[model samples]
Target: MDNTLSRREFLRRAGMLAASGAAAPMAFNLSLMSEAAAATAPSDYKALVCVFFSGGNDHQNTMVPYDLKNYQAYATIRQSIATPRDKLLPLPGLLADGRQMALAPQLAGLASLFGQGRLAVVANMGPLVQPTTKAQYLSRSVALPPKLFSHNDQQSFWMSSMAEGASSGWGGRIGDLFLAGNSNAALSCISVGGIGLYLSGKQASSFTVGVTGNPQLLWGSTNLFSPSYINELKVLMSTNKTNYLENEYVKVTQRGLNTSVQLDAALKAAPALSTSFPAGNSLADSLKMVAKLISTRAQLGNNRQVFMVQLGGFDMHDSLLAKHPPQLKMVNDALMAFDSAMIELGLQDQVTTFTGSEFGRTLSSNGDGSDHGWGSHHFVMGGAVAGGKIYGRVPEPIIGGADDVGQGRYIPDLSVEQLAWPLAKWFGVPDSDRYLVLPTLARFDADALQIMR
Candidate 1:
């Protein structure tokens, strides 16, 4: 008798598996099972924190070209949305090319970090199927990332290197590679941000946490219900499970409870941070929790960790001038506090933090705001980063310049995978298995940006 199931049968079973709180395996060219079989334990500890700027961000305003020539051109095209060149905070260390670069007025903390040589920028980076040029983009001669400038699709692609609806993001895949090394494998990938594809992998799963660092459960109470009710609830969920599905549900609930208990114990045992995180700032709250986890990594018994935190309201389509500044200020304050906390813990070199967005907005303004565009500038911050430098090409701000596809929406000179390569390598994924974490790694020059030490 044949053992193979028909396609419809497979789908039916897969749906059942999903409904039972177990993730159905994602199909890929190389099985993640093979990756698990070859997995090696990491000897040392490190964490990668992804700070995602939700909605399309205007990279043009984030890092401005400050020389007389470039500044004029940038200001000319940007119009009402331009940050005055005088108001920009000048970075003291090294300037890109022959021109000085400055951060927006709100990003004072980041500018100071740049001067201290702890932060760097990767310019004109975006998702691409292969090397693409402005002409190629216009003519459709080269393959581009699907659904360009789309909010959800670009966000998914930026995180997973796949289009929307993709399972298994790169962060979780990295968690998969080092699952054997972790004493508590389930804690390898964590998310303080929303449920993004960035934190799910074929074999690795994300454990969600809130901003305050306290562990939570799906079936347990927080403020409204008493902690004493947890035992009663756990017993109720686990009791009298006869079938496999029921048993699996009980197991998932138990796993969550265990993680909650373990994390709560570790957090309570750890010393509080001397560094201060701003109150009521969502990003700061998330990063503060991440710092706490990093400090308590030993108690959690994980050698490698991946974390995600996010900030939103970057979709400055209609009110660029009025809306963008406060967001930048929040980012600046949160990033500074997180960096200080890492330094205080003597883990500055052990942890790397980076910023990302779905896509960049157009350089040319449409009266009130800017439109979504292709390439964007991003920041890499940590002691190990080759800071005070700009990696990849900075797009010329001229409306119809060499790099612009149209409307000053610059074409990317570097792919998103190229930016992730060096960071993943620094996080302890070896060259051979880099492709496991980043599926698009094969198409780009690995570690070309060379941002890490």
Candidate 2:
């Protein structure tokens, strides 16, 4: 084999390196300038947290019906996975059509947050290319999202407005717009959930942190092996190269080292939070680290920030009744702890946390479990949220119902563009400039989705 590499081979190797280094807190890209127009920082600071549930969650079981009629309908359809009527914690008030909603017993903490006006449920939200209904969906007249019900594509579509393999996402695009506003632009977008497209922007790239604290490794904190041996390794990483692929690697490694040191020092000096996160819970672990990072916002000079945290194992195609409840408990407990941490920091009003899944699972059970679905219920929590209310219309829980495309998979009443509008507005994006961050914003009137205060 020849020693020299071809251009395509080099690019493929570079991609492989990126995949392996996703968890590192590094500046991965160096392209100067971007399409996200710079804007002045808002007087007050704000942050957005996206908690992605890796596999599609079973939302039908997550938010159950409370009314006698609807509960019977849900219980009958859900069969094995149905949350008991008496065991459900009812959310106050009813949907637009007088249908009442309740939470799974494991989600009582979130329900309490809802009662305190710090949380609101966004019902039946999913990716849509346009404002589509059952008629348009059935008639196949509207442009629909490509690769529907696909885990990977929907995850990408949920983060980025486009389908899988899109270069940028709304969060990263939002990060792009405010790069100049932050005292240290590199710290604007953080990810505790490793590398993801959600944090990749036109010019801005994310600085990934860990679920514990800033990572301290031999390369990051100490000289490896012999002094000269580690010194040579550092030299190799720091040296600039003529090839684009080689040069990008040099930049990513060097930036990772530099940022790690800075972040570690800042976190060490930051005060500890009084709130206690549940032990051994992965979601709580991630959110606890997010809280710690937020505690250093003033010192890091991060005025506008977006974070991505994630948990896996929600696919639930089998053993759903047994496996799902524990995960839901984790979600409820972690969020409760995070809310407390924010309150302790007096940043609850400033930070907004939301949950996301690739998609929802079907209402019709496949013997012991549910299948993949389209529309799902999600939670948004913060002091600014219009809590104690359900934002979108919760579809009835009947198989072959009006909203169902098939197998009790209801068509979403609101598009993801409509959902993200209020969040972008609350985070300081100008109304006229939203099209840059959200491509399909023009198709929907986001005015009605007043999710924030």
218-280: candidate 1 lDDT, tens digit per residue: 333343112455466567766867765445545555565556667767887999999999988
Kindly list the per-residue Cα lDDT of model 2 for residues 143-188, writing each as its tens digit.
Answer: 8888999998988888887889887888888888888887667777
Candidate 1 global lDDT: 0.79
TM-score for all models, in order of appearance:
0.89, 0.91
Worst 10 residues of 2 by lDDT: 27-36
Model-by-model lDDT, in order? 0.79, 0.82
Best by TM-score: 2
Model 2 segments beyond 4 Å from truth?
1-27, 31-37, 216-253
lDDT of 1 at 240: 67
